[model samples]
Target: MAQDFIAPSILSADFARLGEEVDQVLAAGADIVHFDVMDNHYVPNLTIGPLICEALRKHGVTAPIDVHLMVKPVDRIVPDFAAAGASYITFHPEASEHIDRTLQLIHNEGCKAGLVFNPATPLSHLDYVMDKVDMILLMSVNPGFGGQSFIPSALDKLREARARIDASGREIRLEIDGGVKADNIAEIKAAGADTFVSGSGIFGKGRAEDRNRYDTIIGEMRTALASVGR
Candidate 1:
């Protein structure tokens, strides 16, 4: 299995102090920075673009930036993100007119390519491009928003995706985004999600009260994951 990763979504972090929040989270044990890019047309919300990603690099954050592009016409923006320092760029299959081409474009730009599947989106999208994807992200909640509960049906979906990854005999990572908390991470891991993305669960209101807030939650999450024994 690929190594487990705890990717903290910066969507729930303080945008005013984004650089510090990212730095602190990494110091607190986060593996990758989950950057959520939302465009109002594809998803109801509008969010940060590549400039913010570039800013982070300038801010001296060297950890991998996992860029989840929730934008329509994803192909045009692929290279921009790669230039902005994105280590991994994932997009929903439905958003791209040519899924295979988009995957190729991302690779051509020198970033790890990935395909994201929403709760209702089918895994059939992975049928032809399994070899091209470096990671597979499963969205447990609807896109465009943060702080939603984990959808119960996603567990079965995770198992199905895991089977496909193992069958392919490739090193593709299986990532789960949305509603991942220390409480449920073990169960999610058991279902075969190695990369966990949590927004509100990690950067919730409790952060303001505790100086080592991220450490407390991330440590608890790691402890919970340890119980699963890889």
Candidate 2:
């Protein structure tokens, strides 16, 4: 399994003060900034773009920005995100007309690349490109919005992805996104997700500037992860 990483999704953050939200989450010990980029055409919702990423970097957020691009025609935006200081950029394989070339483009711009598998998307997409990816993000809920319930089936998919990663013998992160919370984080971890993405789960009933609120929520997640012995 990959090393444990807690990536708080900023989708649920108060976008009016996005940079501060990123800062507070990291300060509370989140391992990565799980950015959700949704193009209305691809997922029925329009969201932050590369400029927001650039703004975060400009605001001094040096922690890894895990960019999840839920956009169609993904290739065009790869360079902009890479230039914006995205540490890891992953996109839906189906969105890219040429998946390999898109992955190569991200690497060419100095960013780690990966593929995101939606709830029903097949694993066959990984057959030829396994080695080319640094991470495999498994969405537990259909992408587009945050605060959705996790699909029980995703656990099985995480197990399958873990098996594939083990067989490859390459260091690849197995990330689980959507509806991850302290109550089920251990189960998710046990299912083989080393990187956990939580939106409402971490920002529960709190204002973005409340660092203590972030602290308490994140601490509970840490405790949950620790209990799983991962």
Highest-scoring model, lDDT: 1
Cand. 1 Cα-lDDT: 0.94
Could you list the CA RMSD of all candidates, in the order they appear? Answer: 1.0, 1.6
User: How high is the CA lDDT of each candidate model?
Assistant: 0.94, 0.91
For 1-230, candidate 1 gives per-residue lDDT tens digits of 68889999999999988998889889989999999999999999998999999999999999999999999989999899999999999999989999999999999999999999999999999999999999999999999999999998999999999999999999999999988999999999999999999999998933677854589899999999989965
| lDDT (Cα) of model 2 | 0.91
TM-score of structure candidate 2: 0.96
- Estimate, for each residue in 40-67, the C-alpha lDDT of model 2 and write its tens digit: 9999899899999999999999999999
TM-score, cand. 1: 0.98
TM-scores of all candidate predictions against the true structure: 0.98, 0.96
Candidate 1 stretches with Cα past 4 Å from truth are 205-208
